[model samples]
Structure formats: C-alpha cells, structure tokens
Target: MPLTITIPQEYGYVLLCSTATFILSNWHAMRVGSFRKSAQIPFPNHFATPEQIAAASGDRKEAMHIFNCAQRAHYNFLENYVSFLPALLIAGLKFPVSAAITGAVWSVFRIVYAVGYTKKNTPNGKGRIAGLYFWPTQLVLYGLAGYTAYSLL
Candidate 1:
C-alpha cells in the first residue's frame, strides 16, 4: 500500500464549505468577546451570576442579555458542529457538491439564527425563526451520509 493517501478532487468543495462554517463560528466568538467587554464580564466567569443579575441596573441588564445571547449563539454553533463536521465528512466523500451546497445554506441560516437570537427581549421566543429552518439542511446532510453508508455496504 502507498504511504500517502489520495485526496479526492471534490474535497475542495467540502473544504470551502467547511471554511464558511468555521468562519461563522469564529465570528460568533469574536462577537462574544466584544459583548463580554460591553457587559463587563471578566475572564474566569462565563456569565453573570444570579445575584449579580439581580443587582444590575437597567442598562447593565440589557448589556448582560446581549452578552448572554452572544455566548449562547457561539455555544449553539459548537453544539451543532459536533454533528456537522462528521456528517459533512461522510457525505462529502460521496456527494461533495451536494454536501457543500447544503453546508453553505446551513451556515447562512446559522448567521440568521445568531442575529435573531442576539436581539433583545429574546425571552419572547420570536428569535427562533432561523433555527426552525436549520434542521432540514442538517437532516439532508445526515441523509446523504446514511445513503453513502448504505450504498457502500
């Protein structure tokens, strides 16, 4: 067997899509850093404690909520990445173009979800519209991976 593995040509499409995906995740991280600064949430503390929230003024409360949203948006991407990366890998091996296109769509909606989620008064639950649309692309990636696996068997 050859020591070096061959890279598939279509893997480039997967790489580009993965790049877009990570850029979105990192952008959220940068946003969280800025929000943390605005909220005066120092390092070693992920977020304001309940007591701190209770004692905060109106402006501080608003800042805290924004920071919380930024943190949640970034963490939410991390949660999804667990599945996205693996599924992208499995599906890309067999269907790179389709996988890449869907991945791009997924990344775009995640941006929409993050933007909406970071809006103030999110307790109203109106910010989940983008989240609602996020599942289909993910399911498709999973479906492709599943189909690939089944075909190989």
Candidate 2:
C-alpha cells in the first residue's frame, strides 16, 4: 500500500528493535545446537537430527526445556511487538519520542529476558523473573500504540 504515515525517527527505533530481536532469537536457536555438540553426553541413536544433537549430547533435558521456553517467549515477544507496530506507526507520527522510547525499552527487556533465561540451567522461577523485565516493555509499546490508535480515530 501507499505510504500512510511518516515517522522516520520512530520507524528507525522500531526497526532497530526488530533487528535486535531477530539476532537474539536466532542466536538462541543456534545455542540450542551448540549446547548439544559440546555436551559430551549421549542420547539414544534415534535422536540424531540436527535439533536432537544438542539434546542428546548435553543429556540436558533442562537445557532443552529452557530452549523451548525461550522459543515460546520470543514468539510471544514477536507477536506482541508486531501487533503494536501499526499502532506505533500512528502513535509515532503524533508522539514520536514516547513511541520510540517504548520500542527501545521493549527491545532491551527482550534481550535481558533472553540472557537471564539462557544462562540458568533450570526452569524454576527464572522464567518468571525474567518476565518482569519483559512485561513493562510490552506494556509501554501497547500503551503508546494504543494512544496513537486512539488519536488517529
């Protein structure tokens, strides 16, 4: 579609956030493989796919579980962020600074969440703890985006 909004500054922030998430998400995915290769542990021969290599070598059901958790959390991050983009675009046009800051905050929280989640070996309260960082980021984006949507209508 033709351009409907203009906010280069906010767009840049949003794009940067998206790029950061992409890098972090892919890195986590690769770490799943890397952890397997270095595990020196073994799994049943049946578990020999590229994905299974990590699980097998590490004998780390916990690590495997963490990776799965990360995948889901990152997916949720993407889901919420993308959902807010349209609202952000509109919001940025009107409240560029707020929107940009919100986007930046969102990216930061996601990165922190990934770091905290990945470093730990188990999935006890770590996920919940890291999520504290993640939620505000999402909330900021949603708040700003909502404001923009409201202003546009």
Q: Pick the candidate with the highest TM-score.
A: 1
Query: 25-112 in candidate 2: lDDT tens per residue?
Result: 6765565455445443244321234465444544465445555555555556567756655655555666676776776676677666
lDDT, candidate 2, equals 0.58
lDDT, each prediction: 0.83, 0.58
Candidate 1 matches the true fold with a TM-score of: 0.88
Candidate 1 differs from the real structure by a C-alpha RMSD in angstroms, to one decimal, of 2.7
Weakest lDDT window of 10 consecutive positions for candidate 2:
40-49
Q: Which residue segments of model 2 deviate by more than 4 Å?
A: 1-11, 33-59, 125-128
Please write out the lDDT profile of model 1 over residues 1-153, one tens digit for every residue: 544434579989998999877788789889999889988999978876767777898988778877877787788889988998789878988898999998988888888888887787777335857665778999999999899778666
Question: What TM-score does prediction 2 earn?
Answer: 0.62
